[model samples]
Target: MASKSVTLAEQSPQPPKRLKGKKGAKTEARTTQIGLFTVEEPEPFKKATPAVHISAKNKALTLVQHKIYNALLANAIEQDRDHAGTNVGLSQFSIALTDLVDKVGLNSNNRDYLKGVINSLIGTVVNWDFLEAERGEVWAATGLLSTAEMDRSTLTYEFSAKIRDFLVHPQMYATIDMRIVRAFKRAAALVLWENSVRYEGIGQSAVIAIEKLRQLFLGQEGAKTIYPEYKEFKRNVLTPAVREANEVSDHTIEVLEVRQGRAVVGVRFTVARKQEAPRLESVDSDLLMSVTQLGIPSSEARKTLGRHSESDVRNALDYVRAREAKKGATPITNVPAYFRKALAEKWMAPEKSSGTKKAAAAPGLSITGITEEEIREKYRASQLGDARAYFDELSAADQAELIVRYNAWQPMQKWRLESGKKQSAAAQQSFLSWLAHETWGEPSTEDLFKFVIKGLASTATA
Candidate 1:
C-alpha cells in the first residue's frame, strides 16, 4: 500500500453532464416578455376629461379619482386577456380589494376611503367624440365601473359595454408605462404624460388649445372656477405638473405659449423620450436611431448629441422638430450647424425676444440727437396706430357691446384685485363668449378677446 501511490483520476469522479432533452422535446430558452397595456379608445379617451365626481360642482377629478379609474381600466383589460376563451368585451369580472389597493398604491387603512373611491368611479361619466370614416360620432357614457358589489374580501365589477369595447378592441390606443402613471402625484401630470405617449411618434409637438388644456386639467367643472387668472393657473397647475413630469416620467415635456398680443391663447408641448444610460455596444447605434427620429443625417446628429447628455440631445432634437411642425416656422437651411448650435446651447424653449436690443440701439440718441423719451413716444404712437386699426375693424354693435361688457366686468375685476382672488380661465372665457354672443351673434372666443384688447387700448389712450 505504501509503495503504490494513488493516481489523481482514481481519487475523484467527474460530475454528470446536464442531460440533453430527447430530440424534439420542448426546451426553455432565455426570453424577455415585455408587457403591453391597452388604453380605452385611444384618441377620445386620451383627450376626454376624466373629471368625474365634480362635473356637477364645477370641479375636476382628483388624483385619487384618476388613479382608481385607470386601475379599473387596466385590471379589466388584464383579466379579460388572462382568462382563455373569454369574450373580448365581457363586462363582468372579479378582483381582490387588496389587489386593487396594491395596484393603485393606496395607503389608507380606512375601508370607507376605498368605498368612496369606488362610489365615485361608479358615478364618473366620460364622453368620447371622434371622427370615423370622415364623419363625427359622439358616444356618451357614465360610470367607469358601472356596476359593482363587494363580498368579504373580493369585489365584483362590470364596465359599460361601450367602455369594454373600447378597452378590449381599441382601434386607436397608446402603449403606456403603468409604472410612470403610478409615480405621478397629480392628475394633470398623468394626463399630460398619456397625451405625450399618444402622440409620441408624430415628430411634432402636440398643440393643445388653452381652453382644451383647462378642460383637461379641471374637467369641465373645475376648469370653470379654478385658476381664473392665467398667471395663477401657470403657477399652480401648468408649471408644477410639467416639472413633475420631467422629473418622474419617461418623457421630457417643454411648454411653448402661443400668444395673441400679450395674452397666451394656446400652448404647444414638445415631447421626447428620455435617453437611458448608454449601452457600451450600442451608443453609436442609439445615436443613429435618434438621428432618424430627428430627421437629421446620422453623422450630424452624432456630432451634435455626442457632447451632451442623452436627455439634452433629445430635448434639442424635439425643439427643432417642434419648429418644423409649426405652420410657418422658418426652415433650417443648415441642418448640421443648427443641430450643433441647438444642442450646444440647450435651446429647449423659444426665445422670448428677438433683436430688441439691436432695435433699441439702432435708434440711439447719439446718431439722431433725439431723447429717449422721444423714442418711447414714437413706439407708443405706433402701438396706438395698430390698436386703432384693429378697433376700426370691429362692427358698431361689437364696439357698443364692448363698452357694456367692460363696464360690467370692471367691478368684478376690481373686487378680485382687491381681495387677492384670481379669475379663472373659464370665467374669462365665459365673459368673452357672453359678450360676443350678445353683440356679434356667436363669434369665436379668440375674436372676442382681440376686440376686448383693442377696445381697452383705445380707452387707455383716450
Candidate 2:
C-alpha cells in the first residue's frame, strides 16, 4: 500500500497575510526588526503546522506541557530572529525556567512537574511528515527533542536537526496568542485552538476527517478508548473545544458537520478573526520584578497589574516589604496571597514600634557618624564579596549553568553558541561580575537602611 502524496498543483495557494491594519483597529502584531526578518512579539507565537501534527503515537501534551512548548517556541523564534547576523544557529537554546512558568500560569516555585514534562518530550518520538500527502517524500522520524536538561533555574534544550530547521522556518504556520493559551484549562481546547488558527488567514478550513481530528486532540489510543461513539466524542470533546475556541481564541469558529445520512464523518471550521485585535499587554518592569520576587508568577502578577495602577502596586509592595522586615514582624507564610490583599485593599505603610513611621536618618554624628549612602556602599561591597566567594566555591557544573543563563540574556555581542561551544575568557569574567551584582540585588530603602542600621551598631561599638 502506498500513501498518497500531494503534488504542487494539488494544494491551493494561500497568499501572504496582509499586515495593513483596518481603520480603528486597536493593534496589529507587535514585531521587532531583525535584519531581514521581523520577529513577532511572544504572545502570538508562530507554531509550525507539521510539528503541531506530531504523530498520535506520542501522547497528547498535558495542559502545562502545552503551554511550556508554546512558550519555548516563542523564545526560540525570538532568538532565531535576534541571531540573524551572528554565525550561531539554534544548537542549544536556553530560557529562564522562571520565565517559562511565569508566562504559562504555572507556579514558578513548584518546578518538580516541569522536569517530568521535559523528559517526556525527549522520550516522545516525532514522526515528522507523518501524513505523506502533506510534504511528499520529505520525512524524518526522531525524538521530539534531541537533548534537554534542566540546569538549575534554566532549561537548555535542542530540537532534532530536521525538526529544528522546519520549526525555525515553518513554510506555513499559525500565530497563537499566549494570553489565549493561558485561558485554556484543557489540553483538548489548546490542541483544537492550534488546529483551528492555522486556517485563520483563510475564511474557512478544508474538510478534515473525524478520526484524524479526534486523534490529533487526544492521542490515538485516547481517541479509540475514551470516546467509543462518535456522538459522545462530539458531545464531550468537539463541542467544548469549539466553544472554547470561540470564547478565547483570536477567532470565532463554527464547526460545519459533515455527515452521511445523519452519521457524522468529518468537520470543517468557518473561522473569522475577531473584529478588534487584542492589545499588546504591557507591565512596568520595576513592578514586575517586585511581584515575581514575592513568589508570585508573572501571569498572576499581570492580572493584578490590570486591576491596579502602577503607583498603587508600588505602594502595596513597599508596605509588604516593610511589614515583613520589621523586627518581630509576623512572618507571611503565603507571600502572593498577602501581596494581593495588600494591593487590592491599598495597605498603608506600617509604622515602627514608636507608633509613627521612622524618618530617614541624615548624615549626623549620632547616627554612626557616616552618611546613609556611604554605609550602603560598604554594605553592598560586603555582599558582593560574599557572592563572589560563594560563586567561586560552586562546582564547575554549577558555574557552567550560571554562564548558560548569562548567555541566554541576549542582545550582547559576546558568546557564540556552536557545536562544541566554548566561552571566551572575557565573557566568563563578565558573567562573574554580573552574577555577583545580581546576587547583591538593587539597593532599596528598607533593605539598604536595614543594613545601615545594623552597621551603625557595629560602628558605635568600635
If scored against the real structure, what TM-score would every candidate get?
A: 0.48, 0.50
Taken over the whole model, the C-alpha lDDT of each candidate is 0.51, 0.61
Q: For residues 197-275, write the lDDT of model 1, one tens digit per residue.
A: 5544432344566766776666666667666677777777788778888997656777889998998988877655555
Task: Write down the lDDT that model 2 would get.
Answer: 0.61
Q: Give the TM-score of candidate 2.
A: 0.50
Which residue segments of model 2 deviate by more than 4 Å?
1-42, 129-140, 276-462
Clash count for each candidate, listed in order shown: 6, 0
Stretches > 4 Å off in candidate 1: 1-58, 84-89, 129-139, 203-205, 276-462
For model 2, the run of ten residues with the poorest summed lDDT: 1-10
**Model 2 error, position 159 (Å):** 0.3
User: Residue 12 CA error for candidate 2 (Å)?
Assistant: 39
